[model samples]
Target chain A: MKYLTYILRNARRNPARTGLTIASIAISMFLMMILTSFFAAMQEANSASRQYNRIIVMNANGFAGVVPIARVRQIAAMDGVVAATPFAWYGGKYQNQRVLFAQFGVDADSVFDTLEEFHLPDDQLAAFKADKAGAVVGPKLAREYGLKIGDAMPLQGDVYPVDLKLNIHGIYESPRNSDQRMVLFHHDYLDDQLRLLGPSSSSGSSATQPSGRAGNAGIVFVRCKDAAATAALCKKVDDEYRSTDNPTRTQTEEAFGQMFSEMMGGMKDMVFWIGCAVVVSLLFVAGNAMAMAMRERTMEIAVLKAIGFGKGLVLTLVLVEAVLVAGLGGALGTLGSKALFDLFDVSPYTGGFLPFFYVPWRVALAGLGVSLFVGFVSGVVPAVMAAGSSVVDGLRKVV
Target chain B: MSAPPSIELRGVEKEYRRDEFVVPVLQGLDLSVADGEYLALMGPSGSGKTTLLNLVAGLDVATRGQVIVHGQDLGRLSEGQITRWRADNVGFIFQTYNLVPVLTAAENVELPLLLTKLSRKRRRENVATALRVVGLEGRERHYPRQLSGGQEQRVAIARAIATDPFLLVADEPTGDLDRGTADEILELLEQLNREFEKTIVMVTHDPLAARRAGRILHLDKGRLVDDVINDSAAAAG
Candidate 1:
């Protein structure tokens, strides 16, 4: 601490070079902080999705293909099944803008039963079940689009080719992050709307709509007695429908969430590789700067040794200088990133892509640790060479 | 009965081995200086004046024989002990006046005192006193580049004496100064030795600078070839 001024003034010997080195470290550490935050958010969302022990029934092809709606009651009545709901994707655009939130047609009476994590007002639930056009949105969706009860929502359909006119009757809260970005309306309302788009009716659009797919269900969400019953229930349901016209495939909800995680696995791999590259590049940048500093101060180091500083003390000074540079950069990157997120509202830009996105304090701390490690490793070699240099050879410069 | 000589070199032989060749710099030699003596070593390049100074200052060790200063045999001290010994006992003045360019004049003088366990206030007082002794008290905040060569040398001298060491070894202390500034530096050295009783061993190529010392020894080919007693130096200062 006594020599801190000397070490710091030595760093300021080349202000531009030191500034650039710090900036580079800050930028890379900033990237690491963001990436770490994103992974945490992703994992948290996935963990939240697994709070209920449930299974999903979809057409054998995938969720893109629909299961028959008739399977709902049969699955609900199956042994070890608690409740079941038809969850059909209604990929519609709101106000002609492609707002990227999930729009699903679900059986209101049974969806809250199957996905037990969600809560809504009893009166709002009654209203949702009474009116075919009544809809309920998650809390985040309501906040994101500034939705309130009694507001009208007009969605132009692109998948089913049937537009929906829905009135906001309720806003639901959920423990799960992804669930907070969903809009669930009655599946029967969608079927009825599709019925009006028949060949005999000229109702919503002039474009020809696909026929005879009105009773399709994107998925039949089934809650089991517990996690242990999910696999057996899924197999029983799949086996029960194997001989039908629309053969079904089923899985535990956790497994279904893992499928989406697998999709993100590719992107996560890319991010991880990019993070590794940034660290390596930062090390080289910091190491080169330390080496250059050592070269410039060769005589200065010799003078320090001659004036009574031991070789260990000289080595420590150089290493500490390097660490200080990298540590400052790390602090700027990590703390600055956290502060930036705190200062801004980033959800509107995300379009509900990442729910509950946040940079944890632990991630910031880890980032700082990485920066310090980078400093230590980079400075060690240069410090050794500088400390080991002979005072006679160093004073040779004067001659 | 008087105090033994402050510095003693008995049969000191020094050599450097580079690429498997032993290049002898100092042959077996004997010399001594009294507690308050001011001595000058004059020689051409490669004449072992600087080598002898380094040995006497504990900056280097002899390949053979003993180099003693202030009653401690330097060759017997361990590496760390010798460094501590130098810090407590020997002060050095280089030809370049090697002040750290980034530090102010006062900071440069305070450099050596940092090795001691002195409190910050105590170190500051010592620095002020050393700077005052070298007549650089008011210029403590000035940097090396901002000061003249004569002033920079004064700062270096202040740094050397900051710990109040027993011995001072200056290798061409005024080599970079002009004739006028050189005389000023020589007089300052004379003051340190005269009024303060500092034992100074200076190496120089300039004959005029050599005459400023009480005794002068000229070296040729690693041996003392001429020894002269400059009786005029002590009277002038």
Candidate 2:
């Protein structure tokens, strides 16, 4: 404890150098924290999709192609399948085209059966079933847009060309916070509105609507009785549609989420590599700073050694100084990132991709671990040099 | 019959190697200092006076022969053990007054005691007594750069003796000071030797500083050629 003050004072010997080193470390650590948090959020989203015994059936051509709604009945009647629901991407905007959220047009009758994680009240479900133009919003989305039950929510569709005016029937809660950012309504209401707009209406433009049918869906979500049987069931469903005119691609919900993440051009791996680069750069920066400090203190180190301080003690003193700087920078970067995320809503920025973008405890702990690693790596060379110096020769050094 | 010598050097040889060249510093030198003896080593440049002091203080190892201090053979002890021995037994004063610039006088004086298991309050008391002994009681809060050359040397001396070691080794203790300040420092060393009964081996080229010592030895070519006793100065003091 007595020596700690001496170490700290020595670190402050060159205030400008120390300050710049700390700032560099802080910036790199902040970048690392953000990257790690982003990767963690992606993993959380993928993991959330894995918890349910569900499979996603999309067009073999990929997510851009529409799946026929008539396939939902065949999928539900397949072996090991409990129920299936057709979910169409509305890509709707609220008030303006910029206010976007995850608004999906789903089969209202089979949604709860397919997605048991969403907890909606029985009365609210009955009201949504009774009203053709009824929508159920997640609690997070409701709080974000200041929505309440019984309010009419108007959405401007970007992809479908139909403007929707639906009543907010209920706000559902889920175990995962990311799951509570969705707005789901009946696909039947969308098809009925499109048919009323006539084939010549702008709302019924051929570019916006799927050809050959008014009831086509973007994808079908199939629920299975056993999660372990998902791979075989997916194969069976894909095989059933393989001989048809429009083949289907069937996969587990987790795989579907993974494919979406991959469609973003390997963003998760890019983030991981960026995190690695930041850590390496930080190591070099901190190491150079410590080496410079050691060079300046050569005589002082010899003085300490001549005064009977052990090599281990001198080494520890230097290492403690390095760790103090790194730990302070790490704490600032990580806690600062948390505060920044909490102050702003980033879900809208992600375009509803990452519903939960906050830093998790694991990512924060990993950031701190990286900081400690940087400190250790930075201090090792200088600490060894200080400890291994010859006292007689060191005393002869003028500076 | 008397107590064993405070420090003993037997045929100690020291050599420095630069690449393939082995440059000899001290060759087959033998010397001893009795307890409470004030000894001075005088020589020209490169006479191996500082080298001998370093060997006695356990800062450097002898190339051959034994450096036994306070009844323990330093050459036989490992590097770590010698370091521990030096902490417990030897104090050093440098000509440059190598006080850690970042620390205050009190902190500098308190540095050696940090190696001990002493409490903070006990260490503070020791630093206070050391500073007072050097007549810098109120200057304890001043940094080395803020102090005069004489004052910085006094703080360095205080740091050397703060741990109450068995022997004090000084290398050109007043070489960097003016005549007046050098005399003051020599007087302080005299007081420490007389009052505290500290065995001191000092190296210097200053003849006046050598006169203050009880005995002086002159070295030439790594071997002692002359030994003189200052009887008149001892009687006068």
Candidate 3:
């Protein structure tokens, strides 16, 4: 009890240093929490969208572009391809806003049937089917465009030369996959638009030729009978398309997600380096604060030591004071970071890639653990110096 | 067992080496203090009065001889054992009061009792009794900073007697106080000596304070030069 009082009194004596130390700890913890939460949220979204039983076949050259719809059909006819859908890449700009988003033209029925994540209401589904030029936008994109159920959106395609007039048939939202903001239109609309804008059969060029179907569909989604059959099915599909004009690369849904994540190499490296630097800098700040506090309280520590307080007791007193300050700071920082997320919207506009900023529990727990460890590490040297001081010398010290 | 001599020093010597020189503080000094004796040591600055007092109080070590207090040789004990012996057998009153500034008078008085196996209620009772003995029961909650110099010294006295030790060792207990406060402290010490029968060995430079003791021992350098018993004290009815 005496030791506790002594610790509290000492902690109270230097309010400025203690407050600064706590602030440093809080900020570091908050940053760590934010970074970890951001990454973990991305992983959860990826995991939610990734269908393990499905196989995604892309260009063998490994890049984002169009593959022929004929190629998609061939891959669909392969064995173990219970269902397959052609998904074309449409990088579109809305109303010249300079904000880029994903747009995919799929066989809407087959897409809704094969990919379970594209869940929409029956009315919205019917609306999408009734209108040939109709499109469905993710909830975030719909909100950004201020589009209602019947709003007509003029979207400019980045790769194709056609400007599309798409009616907003429905708004799609998924807590996990809701981050994928895209406009999905009917594949027939794109195919007809291309035919209308191209040379006709009277010119001795078939409009339905492979060259005319160049941008028909760049990707195909194939679902195997079961998860265990996906690997063999992927190899079989790749082997079947290996001799075709447009060869294919097949991978499981998870591997495709990992490939997308690996695309942002620069951002991932920046996150790693920034995290390391922040933690190291915080440790230095915390260490300095503890050292200064210990130096200023030398006389008080000496007095306690002189009056029959054991060395261990004195050390514990100082360390407990540090831990109290740091732990309180960490808890406040975590809570404050959460509150900050609520009060201020800091979601990065990284080309519509992420949504819903948060602080993960693992990150919070790790931050707290680091704060405690820093408190102990920083206080140890100073506590030892105070405790090991000679009683006679301590008594002689004026301050 | 018989009543212990409270403090005993036999051929005790203290020496300090300065660079290449060996300086002796106490040279082969021998003394015995009775159970309830009130003794004072006085001499010049370089005299061994403080050194001898420290030896008797078990606060310092002897280079060549035994410092026995209440039948235990202080030289043979470990640091922890010596601290325990000091807490058990001797109390100290310093010139500076040495009260922890953060603690109240009552808490300061309760410090020595921490070394004892007394319960909290019993400790509180004993602290109250000690404060009453020093006439500071009314100011029990006053901090050291809140009290006057004289009041702080009285609190120090309360702390010294809190554990009911066999002996009290004071080094210039009145050195920092004014004449009136010094006289009050002296009266308190005399009362303790008379009423409680606590043997006291006080080191002082004040001749008047020295004159109040039952015996005054004068020293030059490190050896005792004069030892005299006060005739009035001996003849007191």
Candidate 4:
């Protein structure tokens, strides 16, 4: 404890240099925490999808193409299937073009059963099942548009020409952040509207016509009776569509979520690489600062050695100083990042993919681990140099 | 019947290498200092006086021969063992008053005691005693820069004797002070020698400072040339 005062005072010898080094470390660690949080959010979405025991079967041509609704019944009757729901993307603007949120057309009767994470009251669930134009909105979407049960919400469609007027049948909540920014309506309503617009309204040549036929759906979501059977069920579904006009591409919910996340220009890998670059840059900055400090304290180190401090003790002192600097920076950076994330909503940055983006505890811990690693790497070279120099020669130095 | 010599250098030789040349600093120098003896080494520039002091203090090793101080051959001990031995047996004073600038007077004095297993209270008591012995009892809180030349040297002296070592080695202890401050420091050294019975080996070029010691030795070109006993100065003391 007595010696700690000396080490701290020595660090303050050049206040400007020490302050700059600490600031650089803090900023780099802040960047590292942000990158780590982004990856964690993506992984969180993937894990949430896995927990639901859901699988997505889309057209092999891609999500733009369609799957037959008849496949939903076949999937539900499959050996490992529990329930199935058909889903289609409705890129709608609420009241104006600026207010954008995820709006999906789903088979409302089986949606709650397939996605057990979405929770609504018993009466509201019955009300949604009974009304033809009823919609279930997420709590966040409901709060954003001042919606309540039985409130009428209108959406202007950009992809399709028909405008949708829906009654808010229920407001559901989920533990997962990604699930709380969406609105789900009956897929039959979308089909009716598209049919009213005629067959020419289908923009893509590959897009299937909404003809109220048994074989017509944008995508099918199947819930497996056992999550471990997801792989086998995916293979079975793919085989069943092999000879059909539009063959299917089937995957577990986790893989489907990962694929969508990757579709955003491989951002998960980019964030990981950016994190690596931040660590490397921090290592260099910290190493240079420690080296310069050791050089300036050469004479003092010799004085300590002469006064009977062994090489091990000297090395420990140097390492302790380095760790102290890095630890302080790590604490500030992590706490600062936490505050920034808590104050701002960064969901727009993720393009509505990760609706709930915040720094997780594990990411904070990893950021601290990186800081300590930087400290260790930076301290090694300078600590060895200081401890290895000849005491006589060191004392002979004027400084 | 008398105690053995406190320091013994038998045929000590030291050499330094400059790229390709082997520059000899001390060659076959034999010297001894008895217990409680106050001795000084006086020489011209580059006469190997400081080198011999370093050898005696166990700060450097002899190229050949044995430097047996307090009956332990320093050359045989590893560098780490030598450092521990120095901490336990030898106290050092430098010409520049090598006090760690960042530490206060008491903190600097407390440095050598840190290596010991002494408790904080005991170390503080020892530091206070050492500072009082050098007559800077109330100035313990002052930094090195806050003290004058004489006071800084006194703090250095306090630090050198903080562990109560058997041997005290000083290299030009008053080289960078005015005459008044220098004489005050020399008087302090004389007082420590007479009162505490410390075995002092100082290296200095100042004749007056040399006269303060019981015996003085002169070195020229890595060899001792004179051994003068200061009986008159001793009588004055």
Candidate 5:
């Protein structure tokens, strides 16, 4: 406690060098946290999916292929299945701008059952089920676009032959951020338009095309009766469809989330290595600054020893000052990163992957730990050298 | 019964190893100082004056002989024990007034007392008393850079005496000061010796500075060439 003033004074001895070193560490740590946050987002997604025993049943070709809508009924009647719904992606444009929030043609009545986390009032849910054109927007999407219950949400088709004129009937709130950023309407309404406008009518793909993607579901979401039965049910569904024309692959919701992470697994490693490179670069920056600061204090250190300060005390003070500088920078970086994600909605920039990009306390703590480690590494050599140096030579060097 | 000398060196030989070669600085140097004695060392450059002072102050080890200060054999003590002994018994004043530039005068004075078990209030009181004794009562908050050359040396003296060590070893204590400031510093040293009875060993090149000491020893080529007793200087002090 008595030595704190001396240590802090020494840390602030050269304001320019200390500020530069701190800035270097802060920038490096911010970049590292940004990269780590990507993986944290994926983990958060999987963690949310694991809360319920849900399985995603997609066609063999994944999103490129569509499953027959009749399979939802067949899966719902399966032994361990509790509820099932057809979930299809609608690539649409709104107000001549690309829709940032996801638009999906979901079975409105059963989607509320499958995604039980989304909270909609009983009246709002009934209103959505009564009208085919009624749509429910997630709270996050409503907040982003200032959408109200009676707002006319018109979506121009990008992937289908017909457009949708949907009226927002409900906005769902969920504890999970990702689940509350989607727009879901009755699949029957979209199917009615798809059948009316054949493949060649509006999209002008081909005039003689006999078949279209009508009455097809992009994916089937199944809620199992028990969590432990999901793996077995996924295998049963995939094996049963293996020999059929419309083959399918079924996976637990968490596993489905992991599939996207696996797609980005190699990139995560690259980003991690880049973060490592950033830390290494900061090590040198901090090391050089510490070396210079220690060198400047060489004579004062000798004077301290002459006045009876032990080598151990000197070493501790030097290392502690280094850590103090680094810890301040780390704390600043965390605040900066948190403020950025908090003050602005990065949903528009994350490609809908991370709508709520708040940095977890664990990741912030990890960054601070890394800062302390860098401090210890960078200060050890110079501190040991300073403490172990000959006092006579040091005093005489300046004398 | 007579007490032992405050400092005694019996055939102390000090050498430095530079790579493989051995450079001898002090050879078979035998010296002793009675309690409360004021002595000064004078010599040309590379004459072992400062080396002998270092040996007596326990800053360096004797290569082949015994250096006993305050009745403890420094050569037999470990590094830790010698440091504690130095802190308890000896005070040092450097030629360059080596107070930490960042610390104020009071903080600099309080530095040595930090080694003791003294409470913070007591340490502050001791620092104030030390600074007061040096005639710098109101300058406690001034940094080394803020003070003049002589004031800085006075603050260094206050720091040296803050723990109330009985002995003070100063190497060229006034080397960087002007003659007026040097005289002021020398007078302060004489007052400390006459009033407080501190055993002071000083190394100086100025003849005028040496005259302020009760005794002066001249060294040349690693040997004590002459030891002079300045009775008038003792009387003057």
Candidate 6:
């Protein structure tokens, strides 16, 4: 107990240095905690975005191109294909405001019935089917645009020459990762609208022809009956479309997310390395603070030793001061991270990816553990210096 | 058949090395102090007066021979054992009054008692008694810096006696004080010796201070030159 008092007195003697050490420790620990939580959240979002059984059948080229609508039907009739829905990527500007979202034309009724994940309220579902130019926007998009039920919107096409006047029948909220921040409406309306906006007399292709260029949809989403049947079903579908007029490239959602993660190469490594650097720098700063404090108290330590304080007791007192500074700093950083979450709304990359932001309890615990370990590492040298000092020499030192 | 001398040194020597040569301080010195003896050691600078005090207090070791204080040979004891023995038997008063800066007068007095098995209440009682003996009962709560130089020395003396050690070793206890304060301090030491029968070995260069002791031993070049018993007139004046 007396030793604890001495430690407190020592720390209080240099409040500024102690406070700065604590702040540095706390801030770095908090950042590490936040980074780890983001990593965890990203892992969760990546897995959630791609369901194992759902296979995406896009053009043989990549995600940007489109496949014929005829191929979508053919893929749906395959052996393990429980259901298939065609998705057409329609590029358009909302009210010329440069607002962007995934404007997709899907067979609303069949797609909703086939994919168990696209869930909406019964009223919204009914309203979506009742109106011809009706659309159900993802909840995040609707919130961003202030679009409510029964509101009408004019969307100017970016790819095809057409203007889409659509009714916001209902807003859709989805737990599935793919359903976030998208706009889905009936495919028939887009197909009809595309014919009106295309050239009246093109050289070789007619707009009315079903197998022509106007009839092409972006991709076919094949929802498997059982998640385990994905590999076999995918193989069968690829083989059915092999050497056909238009070949298909099929992949699971996880593979798709992995491709995106791989695209952001060296970014992950940089963040990890920076985190390590921060920790190392913080360790040195904390160590220096403890050493300075120890140096200042040389006389007091000698006095204690001469008066009968054991070397072990003196060492413990110095270490306690260091640990207290570091531990409190770690706690402060963690609390600061939590307060940050309330003050700022962190959105995923601008119109590109969904960002995962959260602070896990494990990260907090690990941060505190690191702080304690660094405190110990920083304190040992000074503690040994104090313990090994000669009491006679120490007493002779004029304070 | 009488009890062994309270302290005995036989052929004790201390040396300090300079670059390549050894400078011997005390060479083959022998001395004995009996129980209840108030002995004053007077010497010029570099005559090894302080070194002798350190040897007696177990703060330093003799390069050769034995230093038997309270009938225990210091040379044979381990460092830890020597420390414990010093805490148990010796009280040191330095010229600068080395009381801990952080502690109050009472806390400084209670320091040596911390090494003992005494209860908190017993430690407090001992500290209070020691302070009262030095006539600083009301100054117990004051910090060392708040007191005058003379008062700080008095507090240090109170601390030395707090543990009730058998030997009080003072190295120029009145060296840094004014003449008036020095006289008062010498009077206090004489009172402690006569009233409590505490054996004191004081090392000082001041002849007037030496005259107050029951006996004075003068040293020159590490050799004893004079051993005189002071009469009543000399002791009082």
Backbone atom clashes (below 3 Å) for every candidate? 0, 0, 1, 0, 0, 1
Which ranges in model 6 have alpha carbons more than 4 Å from their true place?
A30-40, A44-62, A65-259, A348-354, B4-10, B16-26, B29-60, B68-237
Sorted into a CAPRI-style docking class, model 6 comes out as: incorrect
lDDT of 1 by residue, B106-205 (tens): 9999999989999999999999999999998799999899999999999999999999986888989988999999999999999898988888999999
Q: Compare candidates 2 and 4 on DockQ and give the better one.
A: 4
The residue ranges of model 2 lying beyond 4 angstroms of the native Cα positions read A70-84, A109-127, A138-151, A174-181, A197-213, A222-243, A351-353, B19-21, B136-149, B178-184
What's the residue-level lDDT of B63 in candidate 4?
A: 94
* Candidate 1 lDDT, A1-399, residue by residue in tens: 889989999988999999999999999898888888887666666666565888888888785466778889988999999999998878899977785778889998898898888889899999998888989998877887899998998889887778899998999988634557778898998988887767665434332234456777888889999877888988898999999877888988767877777888988898889988888899999999999999988878877888788888888999999999999999999988888876754655686566556666778888898899999989999999998888878877673
Model 4 scores a TM of 0.91
lDDT string for model 6 (B73-110, tens) is 99998767877787788787878888866678998888
Candidate 6 colliding pairs: A26-A329
Q: List the residue pairs that clash in candidate 1.
A: none
Can you write out model 5's per-residue Cα lDDT over A261-377, one digit (the tens) per residue? Answer: 889989989988897887788788888999999898889888887777788988898899888898888877866786686676677676666656666667888888899888888
Could you tell which candidate, 5 or 6, scores higher by lDDT?
5
TM-scores vs. true structure, each candidate:
0.87, 0.89, 0.78, 0.91, 0.95, 0.72
* Model 1, backbone clash pairs (residues 3+ apart or across chains), number: 0
Number of the candidate with higher lDDT, 3 or 6? 6
Q: Report how closely model 4 matches the true complex, as a DockQ value.
A: 0.59
RMSD, each candidate, Å?
A: 4.1, 3.4, 5.2, 3.0, 2.3, 6.1
Single out the weakest 10-residue window by summed lDDT for candidate 6 chain B.
Answer: B228-237
User: What is the DockQ (computed on Cα atoms) for candidate 5?
Assistant: 0.65
Worst 10 residues of 4 chain A by lDDT: A206-215
Instruction: List candidate 1 stretches off by more than 4 Å.
Output: A48-61, A67-86, A109-131, A137-149, A170-181, A198-213, A220-255, A345-357
Best by TM-score: 5
Candidate 1 chain A: worst 10 consecutive residues by lDDT?
A: A202-211
Which of the CAPRI classes, incorrect, acceptable, medium or high, describes model 5?
medium
Q: What is the DockQ of each candidate?
A: 0.57, 0.56, 0.21, 0.59, 0.65, 0.22
